[model samples]
Target chain A: MTGLKKTILGISDMKNLFQSLNNNYSIDLSNYALSSLKSRVEDFMFNYHFSSIDELIHKVESDASFFQLLLNKVLVETTEMFRDPEFWNFLKINILTRNNYQNELKIWIPECNSGEELYTLQIIIHQLNLQHKIKVCLTTLSPLNIERITKANLEIKKMEINCANFERYQEEGNLEEYFTNKANSFKLNPEIIENAEIISHNLFSDKIPGIFDLIIFRNKMLYYNPSLKIDALKILNTGLKPGGYIAIGIKESLDFPGWDQEFTVISESERIFKKIIRKEE
Target chain B: MSYKYIIIGGSAGSFQTVTNILASLPQDFSMPIFLCLHRLKHVRAGFVEALSIKSNLKVIEPNDKEYIRQHKVYLAPANYHMYFELGNYIGLSTEQAVNHSRPSIDISFASAAYTYKSKLIGIILSGANKDGAYGLSQIKENGGLTIVQDPEECQVKTMTSAAISATNVDHVLKANDIIQLLLKLQNKHF
Candidate 1:
């Protein structure tokens, strides 16, 4: 009810922004779901005090630093440690413990935004003393995010929620033992990601890094349009080892055509699927 | 104006009211009804079942990018913000909560207003928060029909009163009257 005016983004304005970003920076966002992208763009403009989309596009095209900032903002990091504690608990109980791998258990975490999920997995592995047995590859779209996460920089404001979620995840250890308090932020224990191979990789355009036993791609596809989602799913399927498991956000579903033939539902409620290794492959 | 979509937002003390509204609608309701209410972040199951208990129509918590279907009632899923995407699809987001609520009422209402324009009908019901106020106003601005439950009859007046203060709502009626109006609209179309 406050007298704050919102700058609406018309369909034409969004199309222009997408075309410009693709042409200038090779940042193709045309495949992203329109609603989420529109909201993100509007939020970015509001935060940066841009009254019009043209001004925002001009700044993005002109300044490298601003463009980098925009990339960081556009890749949403609205995630927390142990998010959906039940899902993590299910991962530990049903997925991780059930697998018997002959080789080191390889896991791929695509788009490790803000590193909350990364740290959460690492903590679980550390708790099980399976650090040597598990090797995790963490990929993200932003190099700046890599720098930030590698430094273990997490906002202090998130501590309470993160800690509460950890409790809900039903872990025995104290969550506070992993963080070192600092000014306006907290540092996650550097040792948690010691065995993690972190790199900058785009899921849409980049090559599939390697075959893996598990792919934790939660919530990443929620912003993608249906065709883009199918494309990404095909890529993930290509990147998974035979019988490898894939887990998406609990609220998300892989209901596209031919998906059932390629992947079997491991846990319908948790959104985990296992690749079907056909006789020909 | 004939509406293609009907969106209702409520919180705190509005569940029973929503159930009553849904219960009154015929099985062949012409337009899709979107219900965006505040819900627990963790409790994902059973909400749709509870909402569908008394209603003749099917209720679903739509998956991300799911295609929209007429006559179905779509409840915003837990821990995710639901959006009325272009191309008659539903888009979900894990963005930070607005007004301390995920499945935010304002986001859904505003998105519906944007997508359906004058062919949308938005209603605000009993609740303790002001999350849907600006969204109802946006619907009004976009030439959609706006309504609020009469504050005097609300279980909690804060939300409806806030909506009334935010825009020139078309109707401020009790729960039964709101149901009657919806039935009339349904009769007019079908």
Candidate 2:
């Protein structure tokens, strides 16, 4: 009984700490999932050797520089190249190679965390030899992530899955062809990085780029609240050109209200939707 | 202490045991249930339907960022890891599969333990893998209640035995006793 009460009290204390941080920093973290946020914050505290949440909160109030570290930790990127190989195959075969929108391709990767998805897209574009026709824009909210993406070095550990996914997609090129082996990492081809223009833009506050032929915003909605996701979907709708295909993570869906009015499912299994053209009067 | 959520994790040879337990649960069971059973990425359809065929509570395969409600069994959809968002909604992820299972039990259980703390009741059932062991330990560490299916009673004892070895479990109950415990907890609370 005492233990249960203590845990309840501990949760309340942690909530209060977050509330304090919100009030002081003007950073609204209510949109992030509490469990993930809590885990990240706890990890941050542990790394910094803060004995308690109150101590961490006190440090944040005292030092302005600590906020950036906190932000970097909280928004840590989790991505892998060629994740869900079948989806990549579908994009390559159905969208890229198909002659539907063959004039020129403008690809927007919103929330391209640390550039794995961006690099994956680049690899596909390279394979198709469509580099000249394709203009890629990758956007993220975190400057730290933008810097990491700019580095273009992927951890060597990800090679196993990346290789497996490539083989599953039956992708033509060898994996080693695009990367130079570093001591503990693999540096991506500089030409591919040059192809992408990485920008720092907040999904909530900043304006997205102009109409894109395809916008990939995979696995990002899971971090948001349901209402926030609805708003984000509405905003993302404006960033797409008519007939533009938008691919979300396979587990995600466009089931929000009025989603059907704007887009239709192009591939239900892969969760790709194409924007419908509504004639402007 | 009262629990706000019931979390169950299983792998091989668990479907029948889970269905049996779900069948015994009453319609008015108010605690939200999160289920993570290991399944292949390509096995995407009909899992919720199969589970709902025997369940009294609403059985659903939760979508990304969906608001969670009580008296509902939210099953982790294939190829996505399920986590609690803001302690009130379900968050689905396509981040690389852990333990070669997309809807990894450890990921969901760890997420649930962080959010609910002592207000969670975790159950580990029959399986071949040790995926749920670390997660059950996390739940127990957060002062939550944990029940491991008795290894002798499990169809495949590996998962259950691993869970028991990982932490000091509150109860080691077979399917029938587990069903009874859930009913008793329900009646005691609501």
Candidate 3:
């Protein structure tokens, strides 16, 4: 066979593999941007020593656990603690401290993969001595993510950027105060995570347990297709209380048509929005 | 060949070059230009401001899910990898940094190569790392036009050289020459 023909055949087989995964798992990956998904699936295949997509599918069909592992690879990306630290400062001054002075603030961090964002929030709340005044629920798609978060396998190297971010916040005291250093990874002090609960929740389908004063749906929306993004935004709008705030990734925004009717942009630079019209119960 | 999008990737010493190219483009240049440059995550925001100050074309860091528009330059925001969406929109990802860099050039270029296919023009400018090489190669493989800044003229030649070695690059021009080529393309078919 010609090299061009071989390449074409290989591409078709790979596409078929992803199609099969989507069909069998009932997870809609058709909406995912193809290049990143293809690259990720290639990485997954390489890691498992499967030269062909068919081999990988056979393994997936045979073992339930392998399928979960593949989902984890394709769905979640590695996240950092205190990513965009200024946003945290904005949250503290503008959203968190201002409202709910009398009651415990309910913050739901949906798509909280591996708990970095939630842990960052927890640490800041601790720093502000607001642990008693806040209840945080962190959720991911799989139990494996929850376990990883619980284990807190934070690489020691990331401390540099995390520390730099903390320094930018101009917070008093050392960043090390929040974490207990282990051999390779630093685990956040149990006290910091004590007020937080981690569980499995699919952002696309699962019903949120309760409304939140601050719903952090950061970075996760960037992965969704147009229809899925609209649906996810609707779900987030539902999860937020009236006048509640939502902070997305700094690069992200609430810019779709009629999005302004649901939420008002409080800080465009910081990507913070306040719920104006609450979703009907 | 005509192109729908012009994508450029650089790191290290390439920011100045990017701004120079942006400054040179005509106000009515019709292609949607996308830039992926390596930057620190915690640097908050300043890139768009810096580029906007020098460039004639409207320059802004695109919001995730924002629709793409012509005659505008969209920069990959710090700490996120940006890509093209199917419905003529921009998408961002918090995926693991490739080549130890977020806003990874490879991911952006590959996605553009896939989305725009032959209707993509990818350029690699001056940089110290090989981050953009694989992506440029992907663009070439997908039948898109790939250009690399002449390593001799680059402040740091590593990245451009890497790109040159990775693929049969369509053009090896200095930043000034690249601007000329862009203007020609803009006038010819755009």
Q: Docking category for candidate 1?
A: high
* Candidate with more favorable, higher DockQ: 2 or 3: 3
Q: Provide the lowest-lDDT 10-residue window in model 1 chain A.
A: A1-10
After superposing candidate 1 on the true structure, give the runs of residues whose Cα lies further than 4 Å from its correct spot.
A1-4, A171-173
Any runs in candidate 3 off by more than 4 Å, and if so which?
Answer: A1-19, A33-35, A255-257, A277-281
Q: Looking at model 2 chain B, which ten-residue stretch has the lowest summed lDDT?
A: B86-95
Lowest-lDDT window of 10 residues in candidate 3 chain A? A1-10
Q: How much is the lDDT of residue A139 in candidate 2? A: 91
Query: Candidate 2, residues A44-160: lDDT per residue as tens digits?
Result: 676677767777788888886897778766764766778778889899999898845457789898865678888888998988888888889999876767777988887777776
Model 2: per-residue Cα lDDT over B107-147, one tens digit each: 88888887788999999999998898878988998989999
User: What lDDT is reached at residue A25 by model 3?
Assistant: 81
Q: What is the lDDT of residue A32 in candidate 1?
A: 86
Distance from true position, residue A94, model 2, in Å?
2.2
For chain B alone, what TM-score does every candidate structure achieve against the true structure?
Answer: 0.98, 0.97, 0.97
Q: Per-residue CA lDDT of candidate 3, range A33-112, in tens?
A: 55456667877776666767777888887787888888888885567777777788888887776775687789998876
Query: Candidate 3 on B34-139: residue-level lDDT in tens?
Result: 9999987667568789889978888888777788998899999888888786677888888888898988998899778877889899999988889989888878
Alpha carbon deviation, residue A67, candidate 3 (Å)? 1.0
Chain A TM-score compared with the true chain A, each model in order: 0.95, 0.89, 0.88
Scored by lDDT, model 2 comes in at 0.82
